[model samples]
Target: MDKKYSNKGLKIIAAEIQGSSKQAIGKIIEENNVGFTVTKGAQGPVSIAGIPHAVAFGADGKLIFKGHPASEEFKDVVREALRDVKVVKENLGGLVALGDVIEQRTWTNSEGVKMVAAVTKIDVDKVVFRLQKNGKIVPYPISKLSEEDQKLIKGMIEDE
Candidate 1:
C-alpha cells in the first residue's frame, strides 16, 4: 500500500495497539516485508475494537475514511482523497521530511555499535531517528554519533 500510494502523497502509519513488544513487531515487519511505518504500543486518534483496522486522513488532516484497507470502499475513498492531493515538500514545524519516504541507513556510534534507522528530525544539538529494527523514535545527542555520521547528517541538513 505504501509503494502504491506514497507517490500520491499518502502517508500510511500503522499503529499496533495489541501490546506487542518491539522485538515481536520487528520480526513481523521483517517477515511480512512491510514497507510502511509500523509503530508498536501506540494508539490512533480514534477508538478501535478490532485488528487490521485503518483510518485515513486527508491533506487537511481531517478524518477521511475508516475501515479495512483491503476493502474496495476504502480503496475508492483513498483514490478520491488523493485526486486533489498535492505533494508538499515544505518543512514541518522545525522538522525536515526527507521526501515522501525517509531514507533508512546504518548509523554507528563512537564505540562501533551500529543501528539501522532513518533521520526523521534534527535539532541544534540532537538528532531524532526512526529505528528500522522497530518503529521506535529516539533522540540522541549529535556528539554521541560517529564523526562520519555527524558529517552525513550535517550534509543532509545543509542540502536542505
Candidate 2:
C-alpha cells in the first residue's frame, strides 16, 4: 500500500498594544469579531511566533494581535482596532518555505554546530528559513545578504 501527504500553510495574525492589558485586548477582539489567545511572555526585538505586534491605545490600553503573518485581511482588522492608538513600532516577519521531504537536508554552522533548517517560503526575493536552533521555527533574511553569502548559505544547506 502507498500513502500520500499534503502540505498546509500556517497563517497567524498578532498584535501588540502599548497602553492596554491582555484582558482589554481580548474584549476588543471579541467586539471586533476576531479571536485571540494571550499569555504572559517577553516582547523583544526578535520575532516570536504566536506573539502579536504591539500597538498602544490611550494611556491605559496595551494589546497585541497574533495570527497568520501572511494574511493581509487579518492585519487590516488589527490596524482598524488600533486606529485610535499610536503605533510605536511594527515588528513582523514573513513566511518561509520548508522544502520537500526528498530534498530536506541538515547542515552545520560556523561554530561546528549541527543545525536543521528548511525553506518554508519566499517573499520579495527574501528566502525565509526555518532554523531549528532553539527548538523554535525562527525566520532569517537570506535575500538581504551579499550574493556570495547567499551562495555560501545555500551550499551549506544543500551539502550532504
Candidate 3:
C-alpha cells in the first residue's frame, strides 16, 4: 500500500500502543520489512477499540475514515481522499507549494517544551495547535512561543 500511494501523498504511521518493548518491536519490524514509521504511543484524538483498527486522515488534516483496514469502505475512502492530492517528494526540504497540503510539524514554546502538531488556525494573536499526541486542540498565544516559532508562524501567515 505504501508503494502504491506514496507518490499520491498518502502517509501511513502505525502507532504501537500495546506496551511492547522497543527491542521486540524493532525485531518484528525488521523481520517483516515494515516500510512506514511505527511509534510507541497512543494515537492522539483517535480512539481505537480493538487491534487492527484503522483511521484515515485526508490531505487537509481532517479525519475521513475509521474502521477495519480490511473493510472495502476503507479503500474507497482513501482513494477518494487522494483523488485531488498533489504529489509530494519525500525528505525534500522546501516550502509547501501553493495548494499543497500542510503536514504535521514540531513547535516549541517559550519554556522550551516541544510538541508535534499542525497549525489548524492562526489568528492575529493566537494559534491553534492540534496535537498529534492526544488529538487535543491547544490555544496558545503567539507571544508565548519562541522567537523562532513566532517567525515560523509569521511566515505561514504571510504566505496566506
Candidate 4:
C-alpha cells in the first residue's frame, strides 16, 4: 500500500450514497477511480441527515469527525487525530487503546516495591496501570521497573 495513505494509520470511507448529490459524487468517482469500493445496495445512517456531509474514523475505527469533509473544522479534526495517533505510536512503539484489559501481572520496581496491576494506558513517558491492590490507576516510569519487568512490559505496552 502507498505510504501516503497507509502511513496516516486511518482510512477514509464514504458510507452512504443517495440523493441528487450522487451526481457530483459520481463525477468524483469517475475522475479519481482510485478503487474505492462501492455497493449497489443501500446502507448506512438510513436517513439523509444531510448531503455532502463528511465523517472521519480513527485508527481504532471510532468516528472522530462529522461535517463537510472540506470544512476547516473537519480538516483540523483529522490533523489532530493524526497527531494523536503519532504520539501514541511513539509512546507505545505502536498503536494502543485506553481500556484494553492488559493481562494481570506483577512487577518489582527498582526500589523493591512489588506491585501487581493490570495495564490501563501507555502515555508519552509512562506506563499507566490500575494497581490491583487499591484499584488506583497510577503511572510508573519504565526506568523505575526491574530489568525483567521492563522487558516484559515493553513488549505489551501497546494494543493487544
Best candidate (score: lDDT): 3
Global Cα lDDT for candidate 1: 0.75
User: Which of 2 and 4 is the better model by TM-score?
Assistant: 4
Tell me the TM-score of model 1.
0.52
lDDT by residue for model 2 (97-133), tens: 3342212246444344455766554444445556556
Candidate 4's TM-score reads 0.40
Best by TM-score: 3
- Look at candidate 4 and tell me the lDDT of residue 114: 90
Tell me the tens digit of each residue's lDDT in model 4 across 32-90.
77455433335555333466677676656677777676689987777777774432334
How many Å off is the CA of 110 in candidate 1? Answer: 41
On a 0 to 100 scale, what is the lDDT of residue 99 in model 2?
A: 45
TM-score of each: 0.52, 0.24, 0.55, 0.40
- Model 1, runs deviating above 4 Å: 86-160
Candidate 3 deviation (Cα RMSD): 8.4
Candidate 4 lDDT trough over 10 residues, lowest sum: 86-95
Off by over 4 Å in 4: 1-5, 19-27, 32-42, 45-48, 87-160
Q: Which whole-number lDDT from 0 to 100 does residue 109 have in model 4?
A: 91
